[model samples]
Target: MESFPHSSACDLTAEIGDYQQFPNPGAEHAATERTPKPKLRHVRVVLLSFGLLCVLQGILNVALRLAVREPTDAGGTEQSCPQGWLMFGSSCYYISSQRRSWDASRQDCVQRDADLVVINSTQEQAFLTGFTMAAWVGMTDREEEGTWIWVDGTRVDKDRLQWARGQPDGAFGGEDCGDLRTMIDFIGLNDFMCSARNQWICEKTFW
Candidate 1:
């Protein structure tokens, strides 16, 4: 049997005890700290990036909402005339409430940059009838008696003109200016005196 010296044996035992207590602990601690720091930094970067993306997305959504809220004039919001004016076909009509003579009524229309309604269609005449029982229109034969002409200097065609039965009879002396009469059975065009005070219709073209 081989025998070790007591001092040597004691030294070897001390070395073993020291190794057992430490045993690469510093390397293990260094690896744990170094590895976790990078992983935590990466996680922080990912979190910040996700938050920034969410903020950008929110801003983009708000911008889109504002753009969609804008209005356009082509969407039926554009009107050819001021409020209370009736828009029919390509023209706008305004029925006057105040009664005036034919010349005065026409002057009033001219002041508004319009003229007495020069009805060219039966439909237009019918539409005017719906607004009032009687209104001074543009027709007059004051320039040449029995030769009816519109205010625009256009000759009144027989086919386009609608007259009540036996109307324009030069009734009550001599009839001159035209008026739409809506007296139930007498709902048609009739020549009346130019000086008679009655409501009038004005018209203007727009597109």
Candidate 2:
């Protein structure tokens, strides 16, 4: 019943024998499972971890912004006024409890990072009316007689402010410095001597 020659059978058997030492499919699968993963897989894991951290950082930034946001109001938030200062119309006034000559008063204001008050509006005048019966203001005409200017070097718009009736008469040869008078009947602005000692008002405005 044998169809192949004896030599042909022996050659076939030799070829089969050569394959005997080769690993089986199951062994190949086991070896593959035991092998270490590719380095690119580790790099991918690191990248994913970094991406997660970045996302967390972004969330933290958003939380901080929300935490630091302040509520605003219609008239805007009211600013804090320093001690011994009175706030009125976005400004603060420092009224001295003692008296000093106009020049010395202004110097003191300068030392305090402020200047003698410049009355800008009738409302401001009313707010400061009773601070003292009289106080040295920033008005002066030392540079030119009758050409009154504020300490800030701006021309005094005489008409823009109220003057004590018939006052600022340049009385006593020259009343160059100005004062605010709140005495019952004599309440208004008046020109006075620069050397006169009187209470003073310093003003600082905040924007």
Q: Which regions in candidate 2 have their CA more than 4 angstroms from the true location?
A: 1-78
Candidate no. 2 TM-score: 0.62
Tens-place lDDT per residue, model 2, 48-131, is 999999999999999998864444436788465679988777677899999999999999999988899888888888888887
lDDT digits (tens) for residues 120-207 of candidate 1: 9888877788678789899998888889898888998756768877877888888899988888788778899889998999998763
lDDT of 2 at 147: 90
| Segments of candidate 1 deviating more than 4 angstroms | 1-79
TM-scores for every candidate against the unseen true structure: 0.61, 0.62
Q: After superposition, how far is residue 62 of candidate 2 from its true place, in Å?
A: 31
* Model 1 / residue 28 / CA error / Å: 53
Per-candidate local distance difference test: 0.83, 0.85
